[model samples]
Target: MAKISLDEMNPAMKSKQEQLLGKFEKESKTRQFDHYLLAQGLYWISIIVALYHFGTSFIGYPATHLHRSLHVAMILFMTFFLYPANKKASRKSIPWYDIVLAIASLAVAAYVWIEYINFINRMGSPNTMDVVMGTILILVVLEASRRISGWPLVILSLIFLLYGLFGRNLPGIFMHRGYDWKALVNHIFINTEGIYGTSVDVAASYIFLFIMFGTVMNKCGMGRFFNDLALAFAGSSKGGPAKVAVIASGFLGSINGSAVANVVTTGAFTIPLMKKTGYSNEFSGAVESSASVGGQLLPPIMGAAAFIMAEMLGVKYSSIVVSAAIPALLYYLGILVQVQLRASKLNLEGLPKDQLPKLKDVMRERGHLLIPIAFLLYMLLFSGATVIFSAFWAIVATIAVSMARKTTRMSIRQILDAFSEGTRAVVSVAVACAVVGIIIGVVSLTGFGLNMANAIIQLGQSNLMLTLFLTMITCMILGMGLPSIPAYLITATMAAPALVKLGIPPLAAHMFVFYFAMFANITPPVALASFAAAGLSGGDPMKTGIQSVKLSLAGFIVPYMFIYNSALLLIDVTPLVALRVAITAILGVLLIGMATEGYLFKDMVWPVRIAAFLGALLLISANVVQDIIGFSLAVLVVLFQFYWKHKKQIA
Candidate 1:
């Protein structure tokens, strides 16, 4: 109900936000220069890089190798100067060695462009100069990835590289005729299939543009508009604070696509409000984290991973958007219903309606911001525009629309700052994509993806359910501590193939792994989003993570449901069947909420909770008989609760 602004937040809360972000988000742990010369240099360099990508969106990409090489070069140069070598390193100025590395980065990237024709001709048999340049590029990328992406990815990439070079010494399905250093370097550097492969290609092509679009929108005040709009609509209902967290986080997630960032940004405002409304600290943190993680599943942007999926699957990005809509809704719906029920159980009341902004007034002031989003979706789904074309225009539209309201207009300085900030934001992701490209390259060279798929299939022994469980575990494990793009890339390479082999449709299989990879941010043992929320809420991280898992129960199940019946994905199904499936799935998720919350009309008994849980599973499954049985069971529980309430009143 209150006006929200970061500038107005308490100093203690602001410090906590910074600490939590630094601890949980690797990308946020960067050196901020206080020296004017260093700061100005970094700013202009970032602006130049951003301008280059912006120009490409209009002028079109260059040759594949040239484009990707330049992309990696720019990212590495910035990364070396921006991120310190370690926690103890100086922040105010760049180190001399890092400067040297930055300059070397240009040389590594420029060699391909300088020797373009020669490089192409020597792809299989590289000369001495090619090998030297390739080796330097590989080392620079690894070091840059380590600095920006953290150690887990660096370790994983190194392991894959080692396997590529030394697989002959291994046993069983792992064995391969190991290639020498020159051959491996040439494959990864000279050829497109290795470091310059699809992952980096998508990063250079689509992800950077969308990142800029999100930044421009944020600079023009869309973030505040989303918070206000969500508050206007949901801030006065029962359990409204938690509902606001879910709604606002979902809206922000579509733009930012980073769970920890989303949690830290929105949770700073919403978590304290939820706690004030009688929600437990852990519950408040869990609510924010769960809702934030679900944002990656939200269509339109879906964290940039959707674009990569489109690239991988050879389908329109709009198709991923369409298939993702229902499931994403189900996830948020589950959180919303559970929070509402919890509020009822605890007798928590919403904020006063008079204290809330009127929906009309809020829309009148900032509703124009919605135009770019709507236009972007229309172009993607109906207008048949390319993703790059749609994204570029969307950025332009955001800048144009901001002028409609003087309050939201972007000044030249603000525009330059957005470009600088957006380009800085992309460094970590671009590095991760480049590092993951090594893994993809290794898989291609060693047939490791097929081998891993066979290993999983053989281990599961053709039982689809068991195999799905194994794949889910693999995805969650791989996804922990990794951003969703590379997480999806890794799992899609290693685990999705196993599902496809088990007769799961390719889309459903990839979606299955994608869901789990995203969920790892809220799963226990390594829940970065939940930990960030906990820091903001002053709750226990492990408890917050566990509670988040309970809140996100439906997310864990919906993937399997879609795998069992592609109708959930709107694949190979008629409209009538899809509508029916949607209704039952909604009901199932609601029951899951009721079961997990332990309340329906009144506090549910253990037997009733168990029944609700079972009914939820049945209804979620794709079977007519199961749906009927599940619906009947739900009705009986509702009737029983009413009867119990009446008897208690009589007593």
Candidate 2:
């Protein structure tokens, strides 16, 4: 393949890049308040919100309704003031209607906070006023979701609402006994199982604090330090810039929950360097996007869904992290291997050593930035502290440790900005969680989740593999439109039960759904992360998304591997079995990557690629006989490729 220079690239690509970048920045960047008074007021509001949560984390939470209502109300208030209704809306001014909405946000939350005892006393028996308040809150949550997370989540929640209200009129498997408007509203509004459900509870308690931690860390220059550390480690290797992107984007994205946000943040630097280092624009974009998305699968601070997963499964947060460790490593390893193979096939060289930062210097300068993460891990994994408590202390640790290095210190203004930015960053996630709560509410009211799971089981004819495939497809389709947290929530509620019914453990089923849900960010058509990376890399969006799918083939496969051999997830497996599964899974991913890239010892013929693909499937199947046959096939293909390449060389 020929490499295209920047000047030689098509004009349309450049135009598309600029347009996408502008759109991404408009969508993902925090709003900049122009009025000093408004800015100061918003800053203080954010700080108060942060302090409220931070204090609650240690001092013990208030009543459930009081705490969650106040939490979400503040998020809604900030969201309305910060994010406009549309791109064309003014950034510098909050419209009068928005101000009213913001005030209404507080009023609604206040109503809940004030009437909590009444709500509990009159549970399942809401009055006209309760219904009215519930309706208003529902609408408010939907509108907030639309403003923040885009229309997909809001639309999905609406569909669920419609289904709940009018299910009697629906046909076939969708039919259910319908509830009246008041009944439905009460169930969703006054009930703890509705918008105040577990999803929002986790978001309010755990996710928000962690987002604040990330924001503070970023403000203190942790993001830059991670990038420099990655470059120092990988910038002189084969496909150095690409490898740097995988490492750096993964590190940053682990804390930054949104894949699109991650791409826009880290891809800005990594994508251009990759393009300069002779990777195709599409490949570079795909690499960063896929790697960034994979960070949601990483341990310690995975995506918001992980917190929800723990809550849903009634498992410890550290357990989720432990299970995710190997698969996340394999996902990145697959990406790194593919990039190296591509670089080797193209004879691409790394950046000059003199141009790269020295590892010792980079670490010496900002190494303290790592202390917060280490502290977080220790608190969560070893100290048995609650995730919320751990995150609260981690934020404090971040602020304290930043002062260790003059360059990384956060001043009072910067600390305030971090608070404001952190609150701003969580708006979409908080809204999405609230809206998804409505879906969960409806699912519980109508028994829709169990019905859907049964339908999938019947469709799969109780075949575990077929059921897994069907669930994966459902998750990907749902995820294409929804954000990761909502996607996982919906899938875990609906599709995971099908897997569990088929005799898969609950944890494995849920984890499988979570994996595919996150993968949707790189899936085609609505691949948000890929599109964001394309914006940064000046690549075609469709091409970059497709390349992302290819590059992340292991991610697409690992869920199934774990579902088959739970050893991959460290479930009831001995060390030897875990080691065997890990080895085979890694090798399978390597071969699959080679097949996808169409290069190994040499450019692969179609037959060799097919064989490699088949071999990978067999190897990842985790069957001993299949593994033996697959390993043999892989060896044979490698030898043939090597022989052919040597003969060609002689010629």
Model 2 segments more than 4 A misplaced: 1-22, 25-31, 648-651
Give the per-residue lDDT of model 1 (tens digit) for 1-651: 455443455788878888888888777888789998889989999999999998888889899899999999999999999989888889877889999999988897788889998888888999999888888888888888887767888888889999999999999987988988887887888888888998898888788988899899999988888887887888889988899999999988977878999999889988988998899999999999999999999987898878889889998887898898898899899999999999999999987787777789888888999999999989888998888888888988999999998889999999999999999888888888888988888898889999999999988998898899999999999998887788999999999999888788888989999999999999989999998999999999999999999999989988988887789999978999999999999989999999999998899999999999999999867889999999999998888888887886767
RMSD in Å for model 2: 3.7
Q: Give the runs in model 1 whose Cα sits over 4 Å from its true position.
A: 1-7, 649-651
What's the CA error at residue 252 for candidate 1, in Å? 0.7
Candidate 2, pairs of clashing residues: none
Per-model TM values vs. the true structure = 0.98, 0.95
- For every model in order, what is the number of clashing pairs? 0, 0
TM-score, candidate number 1: 0.98
lDDT score of residue 387 within candidate 2: 79
